[model samples]
Target: MRTPFFLILDAIIFIDVSGCQWRLLPKEYPK
Candidate 1:
């Protein structure tokens, strides 16, 4: 399934702020 830009941005921000690895981001469909 396709993913949303906002979701990707949020994931990046969250990872940056929380210092979480990119691979640790949620796997759920963005849209």
Candidate 2:
């Protein structure tokens, strides 16, 4: 199943604001 657009977008923004690395994101999230 495909992930939700907002969920993916939120993940990216969260990482950006937190200054976290992409590698830190959960594997379940999109690439």
* Number of the top-ranking candidate, with TM-score as the measure: 2
Of the candidates shown, which would achieve the greatest lDDT relative to the real structure? 2
For each candidate, what is the lDDT? Answer: 0.66, 0.71
Query: What would the per-residue lDDT of candidate 2 be over residues 1-31, giving only the tens digit for each residue?
Result: 5579988998989979566555466654557
Error of 1 at 27 (Å): 31
Candidate 2 Cα deviation (angstroms), residue 4: 0.4
All models, RMSD in angstroms: 9.7, 9.1
Candidate 2 wrongly placed segments (more than 4 Å): 1-3, 20-31
TM values, all candidates: 0.49, 0.49
